[model samples]
Target chain A: MTTSFPMNAGDVPYSYSKNSHLQREVLDGAKEMMKEVIIEHLDIKNMLSSSNKFYIIDLGCSIGPNTFNSMQHVVQVVKDKYHDNILEFQVFFNDHVNNDFNTLFRSLPVDRSYYASGVPGSFHGRLFPSRSIHVAHCSSAIHWLSKTPKELLDEKSSSWNKGLINYIGASNIEVMNAYVAQFEKDMEMFFNARAEEIVPGGMMVLISPQLSEHLLKFFGSSLLDLVNEGKLDESLVNSFNVPVYFPSIEDMTKVVEKNDCFSIERVELTHPKSKLVDEADAKTLMINLRAVLEGLFINHFGSKIAKEAFTRTILKSDEVSAWMKINYKKACQLFIALKRK
Target chain B: MTTSFPMNAGDVPYSYSKNSHLQREVLDGAKEMMKEVIIEHLDIKNMLSSSNKFYIIDLGCSIGPNTFNSMQHVVQVVKDKYHDNILEFQVFFNDHVNNDFNTLFRSLPVDRSYYASGVPGSFHGRLFPSRSIHVAHCSSAIHWLSKTPKELLDEKSSSWNKGLINYIGASNIEVMNAYVAQFEKDMEMFFNARAEEIVPGGMMVLISPQLSEHLLKFFGSSLLDLVNEGKLDESLVNSFNVPVYFPSIEDMTKVVEKNDCFSIERVELTHPKSKLVDEADAKTLMINLRAVLEGLFINHFGSKIAKEAFTRTILKSDEVSAWMKINYKKACQLFIALKRK
Candidate 1:
């Protein structure tokens, strides 16, 4: 294939090979939503006597636990609804063809009730025939940018906040805005396609990271005390790239409703309480933050200062510790269910 | 449910029912095209292998021996494709809710591969779920209007001629145009909604009676000559209220493609030749003509004259005889397919 596209900041030391941890977290999230959405949508008891076939698809699926967890419920629901109706099920696990499907499929559950396959293209919308699916399962993947958004690269972009200064060597707000724009665009395509493809009454449940505008303002007011103390190298933090694009529940609802294909059936947001926490969980939380700032750190003092800066920042952030303690317990998560109109 | 509107048109008999035999004959003519279009467009091989679930719907499915025969192939291809996979299928045999499906399903072959059900709804493309069908099939159903096209009614509003001049009645061009306009409008809604429901790669095959623009000057043009010869009731014929939309292949292609959801794949037209001499078959072939002319002769001079008039009309015209002979052997039919783009 011709490579006409210019390279951008993508791929990392972890890459697809090391993304199993993400999958595990996503699987846990899916398990939680099935009870909330699928049972209520299907009216399982009423349908038990009929042998209507049912299906679920995990769109933008990464490897591991999500594929396993979603398939389990998809299969379970089919069995529950049509135990006597000669029900047969197929669980579609889809993502970009370039993703590590080998690892994903290897980790998939081999239940007789579930079968998985790769769609071999971008998952911009629903990919099955009409009225053929009962549920749609997605987690942690929609936030990834479909492509880098434009308008974010210009230093003078409207998204830029003049008063908001970058700490050390860091990207301006424009860069971050571009990534988010990309996320929004991709999600538009994904949701619109899904609207056309989902059964008239089927449900789609999604879980993804989100950054509330309220929290962003609170942070801007001076949440990063570590950066003032040289405890955290804002430079290092800026260099790291966290591919996830977190949108507030309100923003997500707008995207889902754009095409009149979906009605937001439910929404849940979890925010932790305590503002401080200890180091171990802090590392887990800061991993994404660190990656974004890594570039700036290397640009500043090269790799040595960047590595040192990461440790220094954590040691100094008492407030982050407190916030993490509360947030971890609070379960900083956002969920929404959209049904075909 | 509360009735928001008044019910109308029930007491009125659908004048177009007079052409039911013609509808059957036209559809019969297109069997091969219908089969090929359904088989290729439905793409059961892909549907079965990719998912363990399947769905199919046939709209305007009359006493559907043809639908059953074609579906037999669909079921077989699907079964063969998914023999290694855990496959399940749900098929909905749909037509006008009042269509004699009791007989249709009786003929449906025993296929262990699928669970079948009856779906009763008008095929304005509104019955099934969005993005839920693996395959949807419609044959010979679209050309029949939901009710008589209004233009064909006699001055007393007693007769409705839908471009069809009954052998005993006159035809009004204006009345026929009115019916044609309604046909165009109704079909727009039908194809648009169908487009929205099919999955990105799903298939839709439509086989219906069509008047080919290509054949119009050559074949359809000659029918008017019979009008001059008094064999066809040009005035009473204009009073025929049957809704006939003989959309050319290009016309259907344009409609399906405009929605932007479907990609036109293949199209074909089949012509049914009149059969060799057989009393029962001949009677069926002439049923509609007989019904219409009988009304005129009986009204003018009772049953005896009606018989005499019908016999004289049939015996006098060698062209009518030739047409009857050719049509008895074969009927003209058209097939079209539009897959999700």
Candidate 2:
């Protein structure tokens, strides 16, 4: 039996396609930002002399319909800049080993100009050769940690994030600090690895989830409330912390400065177009959230219990629907373009 | 319902692993020849100056145990030559879409140094971007034509190879010339495309089969002889031409000169190890032949008829065993190293 779905095209149960609207919005915004960044800061003369192969990598490129657009945009920008000097584009798409590459290949655009290949592995480590990539883009993937921090699991630690799967509405200061510390370690590693891989003057554009330090209205934390009511196992909730964090722009800027290999070009905070939604949209969000979290839940508590927990939680919630209608710009996104120093 | 087996690792029915021994021998010889060609003809200083990402392509890389070895050899040579420079290797593996990429990836050695990616397509047309490749290699491929020449199919054409699946033992001069015309066209396209893709001073090494201009002792033509005996349809034999032809060194050199983009550095003819085998060994050869030809046969005839034809042809052949023992080196192999002009 498989623990995880291929998270690719055609696999309806665990595909990213359902939630890809969020990704698409992020891509469009990121592409526009990338063009502006290239126009202002990119060293075209240096690139013309040293680079014959214009290399771009999609750091967590899940099967396309969206990643293809991201690649096309990058290729178009590079081609526009260097039309006189004949440059070839080489694009690498990266995701976990389990991601559906076959589906991705089948969905490749008929008029694709760049030579594309999939690189299977996590992006939190060294995936390419030193000084090989000219540009790297990751849309809505870097928030995922390599693993859940060990302190979150420790019963003795003061920073133990017990009975919580995420730090969305953590009242405990210690638990919040622990999640922040884990994010720091993960971000440092990500930056250092990419520092070695990306050429000097090459840029990386990252679009990630961010939460306002103001009053937090957790979108998916209602599921955990069911566990608190003894409808589900409390220990299951306590042990099952997600390896994801919503870092502030300040948090990221500091991480970038500490790493010291990259200089920030621009950072912008934006919300997806459909940030605030009605009841029907709220229902769709719940379904999408359930699909994303189901594999982990099933692995921990078996399919039957996990299914019941989700169904009851969503069905019982008037709060989730109400929360969805509120300005979800409160839960924001950050687009950061960093140049290797 | 699948028309062709995924020519992969463990799928015993259609995997290329069995016949890969022939490919391995060709690869070993080619590697030695590549070292010499690089040392003598290659301007190492020019390569070191203009290229940083030393790109190599295996044009017809079938699922490995062999292709991996070929990649390692090329990467090793390049790394050895430029030990001082921080040069990175990017190797591309090309094969038909049906080739088993999963098996190839799985078989990739854990200690591999070069960044590897698979390019899925036929080598008959443009696969890579212009001026991207430094070295390209193909082991025991390129004899396979892009398609059967159209003139062979015409009823009124004197070049009609009636009841013959290939040019082997053809009595009609027009039929022979038709095969030659198709080969010339195919070779020109192949060279011209590569010339565009490869850097000006880059290299391509091809290991291909070459047949003597003598009365052909067809290696696997007994299956067609069954049609001659009225056991199978004669039109079936006539229409079913293998998209493969063995050209002499002169034929290749002439085509290369006509293409006018490459200078021939070295061309040698050598046979694979253990080319001659007894009845037991001959059975393995027959099975290997069947695996290679199964897709074509199934496409022409139904799977049932194709299966039956193969079973009867091999089982009934004592002559095949005798033919195999008679110094099969008469059907020679060509190793050509061409420098891009």
Candidate 3:
């Protein structure tokens, strides 16, 4: 279920602070890519002469800590390049309108060199002036579709995502196709909006969760089995579908090629250190998972039952505990950096 | 008596909320001027074609209901012009870095059409990119000098503002000239910075306190006299000088002409409804007056003594009470509209 309600720091403090450790590791990995690709490859002379306002936007800059960390990396790179000019750095932190901007501004790092401003609204459409932004970035975002494909909700349609909250466990091929269709459409809009906002020679780097291209199997699919056995209306799962889609590198690159507004400079898949390795046990994983997916569960089942349901299902599974004990081998993330054509 | 400290909403909430009714009335009076000189005279067709991003800024936008009210007027003017297009209005509320952004954001009106972003900095310098802004508005701010004239503090100089908080009643000719010199420097710098930021055809409207050209005398100069009598040290008054300078229409025009980047479109001097008519009693006026000048008093007399000094001085004056009962006859404000040349 795609939520109109924003995932704000105030509302989902636990999810952002604790459960988002995997996203943080991915951001840490990308800082090297930022230096190697963005700082080295970018036209520094042109940037110095053309303008002093080096505009940088963090697309899904949800809230504090991580957003500040990511912005610091971008600012550090710019400061290294233009240390003499007294460059005015304007960093725009963008998220949905309902996001917790209050907490974000109140907790801003006191030592920030760049001017901080919030750009509220969904990134699936235009949010800035034409040719205003120099660089754009998104981490652990873009996989969430703009909204669920309308076809999946129709009872008469072949792609009806019945009896599942996510397509990861769906047996039907049509259900998978529906999710793919939505991802393609959403990506096209995202690319088109960025093309309009970003200046020529600017760059956009997106980091998102991805499926292993060669692997066919996955772990942790048994928690739903426990849910089906536990108390809840079974048909609620039939109507509920997670809007998040993890695309393969091939699928993402194809969308980038189809858009034709940006030239693909690089694409790579990397495995970030999983939270389950050192920090999370089966019990801890259950709590973290509940923090992340409680929204989805609450949308279908009421909030009163959602926490209890996740607790009952994940706590009873011995396979979940066993799976989490080892460092996860199958999880992957796709990084795509594109230059404006 | 002039303050380096910001008169932020957090620091002077009582004063701004009460004593600032005169400023609000002046802002209300500028609505017609904005329509006539901005919407009617401006090249609206060019603005529509050049970009969908309509950038408006409120320079020295102190926190709260007045900033919101002023912004509402600016937004309304733009909306009336660009009603058909999907205009993305971005309003930057700016003040000194120490200004209360927390209270400002918290008190934003529920129905604002523009996306609100707080820009923290001094407006006497650059705050935005070249050709980035379309229209700018400021109210009751320009009278404030960037800093107090250093000449006033020189003990041997004829310009030394001895035994006074402001140049309004200065006995020495050189003291008045020092204030005028500082005003010219600050205004020139202000114009130069705005010329670099605003688009070629953009407009700037400034509303500020002014001295009536014909007035040879003033009311309420006696309040400071009472303060001089009640204070702990006499030389503190001798060294004190208010940074605020109320320029005549002639003085303002001279600066506007010197900085040729902006052409003067209109200059009007208007009298706002005096506070004596609606909600002010002699005691209330004393509290409000203290609110406005407490920062200055605290700097010279310490916070503990300042409040009690103002209370004791104002409460003892029958002359101050007589002055408050009548509609202020001599108070005047200047409204200037400028077009980027």
Candidate 4:
């Protein structure tokens, strides 16, 4: 079975809260777009007339500082739209049950404009009561598939992704198709749940990373190096597969259309400029990647092997860093806005 | 400032979850009364007509197995009352910002009847949208004053509780008055916040321990012993005051009447039978008391002195346990239910 865990939690040196600069950059780039979409499509008058309180849910909100910023921005946008009306905003910050909610709640902004609550669960299932949420926001999340596709793990299947951690740079069409199929199923579940939770006129804004082959290639090569040196087993590498899928614009559109619960208002692919461009050294890149993937690696290959692989990945940082610089210029992030019908 | 930390978190050997059998007994005794009050006074028809959703807030809900059980019983009672109606229950489990919400959320029942959310905040202030909640339940909490009475800390003040941690059975009327004054202010804030949150016909049920002089006397004398032995300073005991108060029935009624928000439906003093009568040994008593008071002790007198004090207390448990056995027979718990006008 494919397993999903939360990002490295708390504000320790390697925690997701400390190492999520890449996610912050994406959020910064999407802020204007989010504001624009709310202005163009949000049914503010209807929402206010229905209730004096506005409910916003942040699905996949990991231990924050970023989730706090994102939710604050969304509340601000809504507040600006209803400047004359007095409205109370209650934001629900949601994540996996195992997320470090103690850290999240403790570090909450003391002067926040909205009442905050944390809902812990997978977003691929029902979380809130039907027609309860006014707006749903998910960012830097949902690229994670619910689990690894079973077809890729079956020995008799042509889709078995042997010697590869992900389908990013794999030449095998069957492996890539397996990943795509899993993404489709996960998106359908996500949309169906959101459809039930969000009010009919409510909106959903999602921002997730598109595929980046160089990073996965570097990760796979690092593991292969350990195998070649007789420090790791080839069978272990064959059995491991990353439970992340970066869907294309077409793939997302098809899934949304199939659900028929939300009308896609806007879709864009943009290469968000990194604010830490000058500081994006090899060590910094490795820390960022490790912050997101360390738990997954430890769960699959054990901490000792995970540590060794990361050390090896950093040793070849010069080549990886150059490739990342080139890859940074491509459109590598997807933003989509949908309105519940 | 009177620092309020959470209960000893997680399910460790010394955690509150393992040591809260006394609280469990109180909850069990209050269950029948709670159901009777709901049936007699709950404006269920008005609530159901106003909205299909029912909201319940468990104020000061620490990490749980008790909380899960309490909330489930509440849901069952409501469901039994409205068997033919389709109603949705959403329970908000609230505690201090420093509470172990990570453990609470992870340990939630797999087959819960309500949508669960963790609200991290003090219940003495507003934690929900105004006029949104249907029922508010607080058990074995709220005897905690928002802070220790400032007068008790001032050496010049006549109310200064010198060499004593609490006002239980204290000969000084001024020290007792100081505690009563703090409880009055805290109850005012608590009722005002809950009055705004609870809908016009909503209900609130509160269960708190009444004054038990033997327990606090044992605790005070234990610390005094440390001072006599020169292991602790007398001045530290003079400055330290426990932030808890076990209000008499008259104290609670006066505060509720002064608030002028809710009409008191029932007020009863109960002596819950202990199911652990056979297990009420010296070590068991120490563990139970330690689980609830360890954080408080550690906060006031460093962990070293706290350990020394508890060791001394347990050494004299034979006398203390006898006192506890008698104290257990008297009415030691207060149950009050109120309905919003």
lDDT of 1 at B6: 11
How does candidate 3 score on lDDT?
0.70
Which ranges in model 1 have alpha carbons more than 4 Å from their true place? A1-30, A43-52, A125-132, A160-184, A211-243, A271-280, A286-320, A326-331, B1-341
DockQ of each: 0.01, 0.34, 0.17, 0.81
Report the number of the highest-DockQ candidate: 4
The deviation in Å at residue A155 for candidate 4 is 2.9
Residue pairs in clash, model 3: A163-A238, B163-B238
Q: What is the lDDT of residue A111 in candidate 3?
A: 85
Model 1 per-residue lDDT tens digits across residues A30-126? 5646565665665534422243445667776655454666668667765674456555455666665444443454454534354344342356644
Question: Native-contact fraction for each model?
Answer: 0.02, 0.28, 0.17, 0.72
Q: What is the lDDT of residue A80 in candidate 4?
A: 94
The number of clashing residue pairs in each candidate reads 75, 0, 2, 0
lDDT of each: 0.52, 0.71, 0.70, 0.85
lDDT of 2 by residue, A1-341 (tens): 11233343454754666556556666775677788888788875675475477788998787777899989998898778667867788888887656666666657786989887777666777777777788999987777767777778788888677766767666778877877887898788899999988988888999885532221233234446666677677676677676677777898899999999999999988765544232235555555556556666677778877777667656734666665456465656798999999
Query: Docking quality tier of candidate 4?
Result: high
> Which lDDT tens digits does candidate 4 get at residues B1-341?
43576789889988988988767777888999999998889877886564577889999899888899889999999899889878888999999998889989989999999999999998888898887789999998888888998889888998988888888766889998998888898899899999888988899999986533346667789899989999889999988988888877898899899988999999989876655543446556666777888899998899999888877777877886676566556536899999999
lDDT of 1 by residue, B206-229 (tens): 776542211122222223444567
Q: Candidate 3 chain A — worst ten consecutive residues by lDDT sum?
A: A211-220
What's the TM-score of every candidate structure? Answer: 0.41, 0.85, 0.67, 0.97
For model 2, fnat equals 0.28
* Ranking of all predicted structures according to TM-score, beginning with the best and ending with the worst: 4, 2, 3, 1
